[model samples]
Target chain A: MGAIKKFMYINRTAPYGSIYSLEGLEVALIGAAFDQDVSMAFVDDGVFQLKKGQDTSKSGMKNFSLAYSALGDYDITKLYVEKESLQARGLTVEDLMPLTYEDQDDDYQEKPSIRVVDSEQLADIIAEQDVLLNY
Target chain B: MLHTVNKSPFQKNSFDTSLRLSRKGSDILLIEDAVYAALKDSAIAKTVKQAVTTHSIYVLEPDLMARGLQPARLIKGIQIVGYEGFVELAVKNDKVQSWL
Candidate 1:
């Protein structure tokens, strides 16, 4: 395998109203298959993509929110959620669906994949990324 | 006339521009990401509060709830409206302008 580069997918748009969030998720999953170090940062309205109990039945739109749960299976486990964005939208971490991954080295112990970070921490994460894909 | 804004005040000038160009007594509805401008204690809260006196400001209830924003957290003068209310505003106004 070649040297694994860090790939960060930055999501800033809301779901349902636009196609950005869903497309970003799909691209992230496809990118994960390449075996690179993939992570996702949810900022601004992008945080809504991870909201729980999303009922699209009335809207007649596909409920793609559930697909976020499968990110762990693709080994794209690092999901960074910005605290400031959540606070601005009056959302807390509890409002989001719980996503977890299993640690292979630790007897497959389950661990949370979503990391709630402040803007400062998120800025550092963005600065460290080798490639940034914005949605 | 009814002016609708669906972009964030922090990210775009949609809210400010709509507020500026909209005539007094016009209905201003905030939906989608634009609901952020209705938040209390935000950077744009003061401006929204000021605009409330000259315009009838409304925020989409479903959009607010979808964003996990409580109605109480919104600025004092802004009214919360449902989809039906949105339709009523559209019917009441002579024209509808979306500030993209």
Candidate 2:
């Protein structure tokens, strides 16, 4: 009956190395289902999450990168990355997506896209959120 | 005048959230595992340093020693608060948020 609420999901872990990344994604997906406007901020090693070509298959893992694309369909469009993190890792928005594992075989597939910003914006974005869940 | 908890945010979301939104003068102490910010001299330390100058920020001395971190490595304005000093910090801050 009130207005739709805004939710912020702060992810601070990398995938594979720990269970935090996958679990955080599950939480974000659940939040999206409720139609609560959702956004995600990837910090520290968490930036590894949106990498362009993830090969979890060889590591005996399901390719979670596919799940990222599904976020757009759920209206969870605001995926933020720290510019400092990006530079620290020698990464750029262009490096994040534009290729996929399928492309390794010369197939056509669109990978996930990462929007980059600096720490200043990261703090501001956190402050702007009505409900912030950090995991 | 300030308090700080160096624990990872997600590991202690409730405590970290409280620290972030606490009164302007309140401080959130950082040290040990929380000292990950100081490792690479990253934004976390930068933000904490700025906050400490205007507010209060404390670091756990024991934890830093365990990790082989020296006081000289710590950013300016940040103080090394011992265990007893830590308890005193909790008593001083209006509310205490433990991120562990």
**Each prediction's RMSD to truth:** 2.8, 11.8
Error of 2 at B34 (Å): 19
TM-score per prediction, in order, is 0.82, 0.51
What local lDDT does model 1 show for residue B8? 75
**Ten residues in sequence with the least summed lDDT for candidate 2 chain A:** A97-106
Q: What tens digits encode model 2's per-residue C-alpha lDDT throughout B31-66?
A: 535643443354355555556566566677666554
lDDT digits (tens) for residues A1-135 of candidate 2: 468888988887756545788889999988888877788998876776776555543235566766877776666767888888756544567656432222223363544435678899888888888998877
Give the Cα error of residue A97 in candidate 2, in Å.
2.4
What would the per-residue lDDT of candidate 1 be over residues A19-88, giving only the tens digit for each residue? 8888999999999989999999999878878877666543356778889899999998899999998887
Scored against the native two-chain complex, candidate 2 gets a DockQ of 0.03
Give the residue spans of candidate 1 off by over 4 A: A87-91, B65-73
Q: Which candidate has the highest lDDT of all?
A: 1
Q: Give the clashing residue pairs of candidate 1, or none.
A: none
List runs of model 2 lying over 4 Å from the truth.
Answer: A98-113, B1-100
lDDT of 2 at A98: 38
